[model samples]
Target: MSPQQKALVIPKKQGNFELSSRSIPSPGAGQLLVKIQSAALNPVDYKIRDAGLFVTHYPAVVGTDIAGIVEELGEGVVNFRKGDRVLAHGKFTNDFAGFQQYTLTDASFSAKIPSSESFDSAATVPLGLDTALVGLYGDQLGAGITPPWTESVGESKTPIVILGGSSSVGSYKLVKDYGATHFFDRNLSGKQLLAAISKVTDAPIELVYDAISLPETQSVAWELLANNGTLVLTLPASVKEDEGKGRKVIQTFASPHAPQNNELCQSSWAMVEKWLSEGTIRPNKYEVLPNGLEGVIGGLERMKLGQVSGTKLVAHPQETQ
Candidate 1:
């Protein structure tokens, strides 16, 4: 029998998750077992917890962003070994889960940590980075994804407006990777906002990445986007009907199922690793919780309360075991 390990678990029936003792899984071939040192919670954690349907079974673990030290490498895992620091997306499932003392994952889904970054800072970046990359790069290139959108057009700089510059995904892209030519904060109003948007975009806004779900934001984006321009919204694409005069509306879904569409996920991770090494992307000021699997429940509850803003909520799961 496998040894029991501790984890923060959301019960199948629905309610807040609680810390519990569970089985510690060993790595299978092509997999590595990580001692989960830090994890960042996203809104989906609470959404799934509230819905209860996403969990395959009761007492299931939840957490999608993780950073840790590799404890063991299964057969065919040639790139990593014991004691190497790593980070990964923790899409917990009936098979592959992340919120535990030891979690198993395929080696391809994990990457070596840049020497300059702490696990907590790297922990908050992957999911948001992937969203930003998909918003900017997907559907344009069929192969060989490259950096700097300007490079593709050979000096014809295409301007993009990030709708909610303060959002985790938008802010990271704006302040770190894929620096858009223009950015629009949802908080700005009327003439002030329009002037700022106009100043950033020399030709009125043509491309917009709308992170805000507000109706007014949509109206403003439509008004500014030039005819035949493209818009990427984090919400559903049905929100606006495209007139087809070169205008494209994209619905962004950062899912694990479509690995083909994950080039953005791939490119974003590369940029993050580079920025981490270069000191260009600093860690979101963090409210580091006490180290332990048991500490996650309280931390997640605090996350649900929205106490931490522009700061990541993290826990060291390995210490509790």
Candidate 2:
């Protein structure tokens, strides 16, 4: 039998999560076998628990944010070695999923953790950052903006409003540190938010990144958006895109494995380490859950109930009881 590791798995559709022993998979070409240190929970996790969304296999293991240490390397992979601390964007597939003690990460989807960051902090970034990146830079799946990394995209006098500034994806420190000039309460109603934004800049509110994706938040963002503008959403857009104004609504494709996100992710993934090292990007605030893999179950429940706010929930896989 192959070496085994503990995993938090849903045994069937709408099933409860239980701890089970699963085989530790080997890395194929251009992959790394990672011993997971921390796995962060997202809203999608609870959605999957109730509806089995995107989970095709029975006894499914699912998680998208992982920070760990590289245990082994596959053929044709370079710039990484065994024992390197790394963080990766996991997939829905079992072997690449983050709910296990060990998981496989595509080399292109992984980056070495900087000395300044911890596994817990690094784990908070992958899914959220990728979601924002794809929302802003990916064609069709995103706003299709030209990347600042590719060239000098000059600063705009217009303010880009990002609703839900405290969400896991919205909690992105880059916005506060590098992008935003003003902060507003996320609880503001659409008219209030639009009015506050109008006071900040008269540039027409050309772009809005609605990381919350809730109906109320979407409505506010839509109201604030100007003609020929773009609205980026982490979830499906509930707002209708009326014809002729040239406004586009994009549902961000967060997965690194998606072909539409490939080019944008690759270019950005290469800069992750540098971004962290230089403090250009910062991880979200996170709370460590108890009981390792078992703790993640309750974390998902809190997320489902809207009990968790302004913080990312993370679990230690090695601490599984």
lDDT of 2: 0.89
Question: Judged by lDDT against the true structure, how good is candidate 1?
Answer: 0.68
Could you list the CA RMSD of all candidates, in the order they appear?
3.6, 1.3
Give the Å error, residue 129, model 2.
0.5
Which pairs of residues clash in candidate 2, taking residues 3 or more apart in a chain or in different chains? none
In candidate 1, list every pair of residues with a backbone clash.
64-90
Each model's lDDT? 0.68, 0.89
User: What 10-residue stretch in candidate 1 is worst by lDDT?
Assistant: 141-150
Candidate 2, which ten residues in sequence have the lowest lDDT sum?
171-180
Q: Model 1 residue 8 lDDT?
A: 78
Per residue, candidate 1 scores C-alpha lDDT tens digits across 120-167 of 877776666656666666664211224563255455465666676666
